[model samples]
Target: MNTYLQVAAADASEHRTLIITLFSVFVAATLGVTVWAGRRTKDATDYYAGGRSFSGFQNGLAISGDYMSAASFLGIAGAISLFGYDGFLYSIGFLVAWLVALLLVAEPLRNSGRFTMGDVLAYRMRQRPVRTAAGVSTIVVSIFYLLAQMVGAGALVALLLGVSGDAGKNVIVVLVGVVMILYVTIGGMKGTTWVQMIKACLLIAGTLLITFLVMLKFDFNISTLLGAAAENSGQGAAFLEPGLKYGVSTTTEIDFISLGLALVLGTAGLPHILIRFYTVPTARAARKSVIWAIGIIGAFYLMTIALGFGAAALLSRKEITESDAAGNTAAPLLAQNIGGGADSAGGAILLAVICAVAFATILAVVAGLTLASSSSFAHDLYANVIRKGKASDREEVKAARVSSILIGGVAIVLGIFAGKLNVAFLVALAFAVAASANLPTILYSLFWKRFNTTGSLWSIYGGLSSSVLLVVFSPVVSGNPSAMFPGADFQWFPLNNPGLVSIPLGFLLGWLGTVVSKNEDVDGRKYAELEVRSLTGTGAH
Candidate 1:
């Protein structure tokens, strides 16, 4: 009996059970929110688009919640700890994408759309076919993004509970999938937004609190922390300079550029993020939401800068190693090390908060993704394709609920399979695909009057094909021997990311296709008139 108790205590010491318990409570609270939201989900619009009643600020907060996932939270911190200056590249890249969204897409997207990005593009050109393609793209991107979050969740749970890998991730997948389904299934956009708002607040607060405390440990000296971080960051001179690693190798520069493009252009194109704009009531509200979202997300990213450096300076040696070299666990493990290395209750509280934030982040983000995919399948595909354009609101809502469950199940299974993949790389692939397939069509539909059905089709096909092919040949996919076409694993390309190449290709194809198909047959004036009314709210919604 004594030996068994000793074993239990040791497990507690290693696993940090208290943190896991706290995380469970957070999930319970989110579930309660989901239940409340379910009560409000009464019709198709409510279930699929939150009845389009959200104000700018509410929607903005929800966007932040949706955009900031495990990859941003834990993966960024881990990158900073292990890769130093290279990690900040991601932060810069991520922030740049918002600029693209604000300048090029936000108001036009809100003005043009009801549910999906496909709606925005196909509104004038070829509604049915364009909507179909957009729906396919949204689901594909959401699944990729979802799998990354699920993998991160599993890693987090296993680290916190010291459980077997499969068990820990499966628990997160089930919990997150169920909670997200409930959020969209019940409250619809309204409910999903509320949950995201609460989670975003919690996440920002938690990160800020940790950053503050870590600074306090150094007498609030920022430079001192940086110096310490530089000394401990493992890569020596490369710790402070971006191009010092591998002496500006062609491969390194290519990867860095790809990362930058993904962060910038991809932010504007993600289906889950784009759909949040629709939750707002007006185009002005959508634009306002973007500004607020930028501020909140910028502040959160700023704090991560501190958190990442703090982990490297204080816990680098203790929390990481060469064999298990990714350093993804640095953030939570560093928290534990802060208060006597997971033994003290203080450490437990910190771990619990971070873990809780992680759990909440996953639930909020995944719910939004599921909701986006569900909307695409239900409203875009089913109503338009399966129903011959006559599906009722009741049918759409029911189909949405059913689709939500199916997509969630797929994400859970995929997340489990992608257990060994890099969280950051998976997310980057989602961005690449979104930039390629969705962005070009949306942009041309809004701004270019000459864009016709052929242009839109070619853009979708070209962008989608290029992004997928690039990813297949990119280092992450090809580097894996077990991946299909293992010989392709030896990358011929320099960039690890494909957004730079794929996004431009999407735009070029759309333009070329437009030119080819516009020899006096296209009604450019009528399309421009439609766009003008949509942008200024001069016509029917």
Candidate 2:
């Protein structure tokens, strides 16, 4: 890794030129899209849901882009390069999670929701309290996820600039925060969707190209490639097995299960992903979008195996560890090596392009997250809750813009303080929160006739509080030598992820609160109406 860094330093001038040129082109293209989108964004509907005009396929691409964050593109590959099969586990969990979204959440969410996940949750419940709870959940999840993306942006930018300091990273975080705020506040969902679509195309194309090049080196032989990867990994056949990273002990095995549960349930609850459903005109369109997203996202993850193994096979683990210690640089370094080493024209160009793609991935995702957070704040909190649903369209849009600025500012501050924390782990924590806090409430609202305002509030607050508290006390926070704060060992929780406990707890809280509260026939009637609409798409937005 030091050797690679030394080589990068030696060719800093060329790398700088290439990066600048690629970044300039990327910025120009995305900026043009934002301007065009801004022109079309007139009313609150346009700002929040792209006027509900996006085609299923287009929305699908955007969904893929939103789901496949820098963590998926770079962090997973890096994990695989370092940890082997355990890394691929994340890919499987992410893909399977879409099944939950498609079959259970997509059409119903689209049929009942207007602008945010909070919309759907508050549809049959007391509007103000439910929306307020959901608004808080949305903001919390978005902030955590946004912090991860911004930190990743900082790290990727620092790598590309060949700079090694907090100052450089802080600058990058601020720049990303500003760009994301601009994307959301100016162009809204229309601009954000287009940016995501473009980025997804580039991301898929780049991944395919890298996979093809790697296969070409092994004569397109799968067996040969696997053999080489296993041999080169220094763990021999063990590298191809599952227990190398995640299943070594009883505690780790439980943690792995918790992580898997979170990933599988989280997608349906994520505000950014859920809001994509509202971008389409019909429930059928939303369902179709999920199918398309599944296809694209599945293919992307399938190819990641090759990317990960290729990195392990071609580059020594020691060098990769030396490079960044977390293997986040593995993919870029692999591109550099397989394209012809850092000094060669092919290597330099490939590295620059990959860096640009990484930047786009971060920018697009952060924009979507900022939009989701802002929409929840403005639509659910400001417009509906505080204003009693009397806020004008223009007022709501203005609120969304202000919320975007505030959210971006908060993310920048958190990212600066986070400083080099693992992106994948942070993302998993976000998922755990979403699963624990939002998914249960959403499920009950859509399917349970007895669910009331009290149930919804309890579920949201209970799940949110439990997940956050558990994570803070879990091994990820402290106790172990590898904890984020190794010096403070206050961890009493056993698992790295709280989903195993918190998800069930969320459901239990909802059920208990509902059963214990006084019965409301009005809520029952509302659920009956919601049931019909959710099933048949009548009166749906």
Candidate 3:
């Protein structure tokens, strides 16, 4: 049979039909809830911040939904399928990052600001340059991250739905974008939170089901699974070990370090994640949300290991191998191979659920990202800077809605252009940028009293510039330099990830900027009061 014909025939099976039906139901319910919640939003603050009414638990679940992208769902699974134990490094690194968010950043961030991370940083300092810099960084990071998710969503839907060519992906972009915009514009934070929470539960349950079933296939004996996997691949238990390669070079070490830095530090900097902190009413609630988020996220990552390994063990090597040698399609393909072909009722249902969840994940993140971007542009840029704080809350909210439409459109266009790029790789790039640009300044502002606004600006600029430049030179960026200057394909950086280099530079620049501006500081007492209030909530606006 022709390969394309086989794929087309497999997709037309009864199992694929079941999967499609199940997925439609799940997504429809999610959209309904989001639209219902949207009706309560009346003003800008209500829309962007969900009226500051959510408790920590709700916010935390939503945060988990936001954090677990298609990369986590599909990319991690694919990585494990291809690299054995080495792929697990991604899960471990991602889980540990929450420790930073829970222990160091959460409470302080929630207590200090309103809409964007910039709001917190600029609360006590001179607003002009700092706010503008933060606004720019948030949009840039959000755009990069959004692109990866959108691309992943499109591909996942296409693969699961059996849609030929780009049609499925394009449909997904419209579906997800429209649903998410309704979630934000109509229900605001309240609606988005509920949708996210539900989606999180569904995602966790689905992953757990896949993991449990995979283990059951081996009589619940992990050792049996591991042995089979090793024998099949001839890599032994080392397939379950850290590092993708046995003998790592200096360059490889640097790359690993860079990847780790992004995973560890980027959690706090993500715009969607940061905006989540503002949903809960109190600083303590924000702290509690992080604690809950860590537990949920940790549990999900643990399951990813099972799914990835299961894919490697169950699927035929020929069928499981990715076109790019990356193992991206292993999970879904393995499911079809084992649970019954795409024609099997069970397989189709599973496929549909996975596809819907993928769609939901992208939508939730984009809504949050759009909210963050719009809030920064509308509240930080237009309201704070352009209007000199004269704009009413109503005007700010309207501007945010408009921004959402614009950003969502751009995301749709980018998603189409992104085509077949492995989403896991793109997500890593976003993480690198977030860690380099956003984390250092946030940490310094909350912990270092001597930190001045000028230092914050320097850190943001330096970090943003370095990360973007490094990514531009990486293989992924070099592969398509249509967006860059002619003949700039030369890569200055050896590693694909720039977190290790750029994150430190941000911290250093922030420190230096603080020292230089410390002498000319105005309003030390006022600054101290703001810090005190942020921690204790006595002087909160």
TM match of model 3 to true structure? 0.92
TM-score of each: 0.92, 0.97, 0.92
Clashes of each: 6, 0, 12
User: For residues 86-132, what per-residue lDDT tens digits would candidate 1 score against the true structure?
Assistant: 77667777777899899888887777677777777766766787777
Residue-level lDDT tens digits of model 2 in 1-541: 4777778656656668877889989988898899899999999999999999999999999999999998888788888998888888889999999999998999988988788888777778788999999999999999989977987787777777787777988998999899888889889999999999999999999999899999999999978988898999999998889888777899889889999999999988899999999999988899999999999999999999888899999999987766666677788888888889878888888888888888899999999999999999999999999999999999999999999999999999988866656677778889999999999999999988888889999999999999999989998778866566677889899898999999999999999999999766544678888888888767756
The numbered model that scores best in lDDT is 2
| Cα-based lDDT for every prediction | 0.76, 0.88, 0.76
Ranking by lDDT: 2, 1, 3
lDDT of 3: 0.76
Candidate 2 residue pairs in clash (backbone atoms < 3 Å): none
lDDT of 1 at 409: 88
Q: On a 0 to 100 scale, what is the lDDT of residue 515 in model 1?
A: 88
RMSD of 1: 3.5
How do these models rank on TM-score, best leading? 2, 3, 1
| RMSD to the hidden true structure, all candidates | 3.5, 1.5, 2.9
In Å, residue 163's CA in model 2 sits off its true spot by 1.2
Is 2 or 3 the stronger prediction by lDDT? Answer: 2
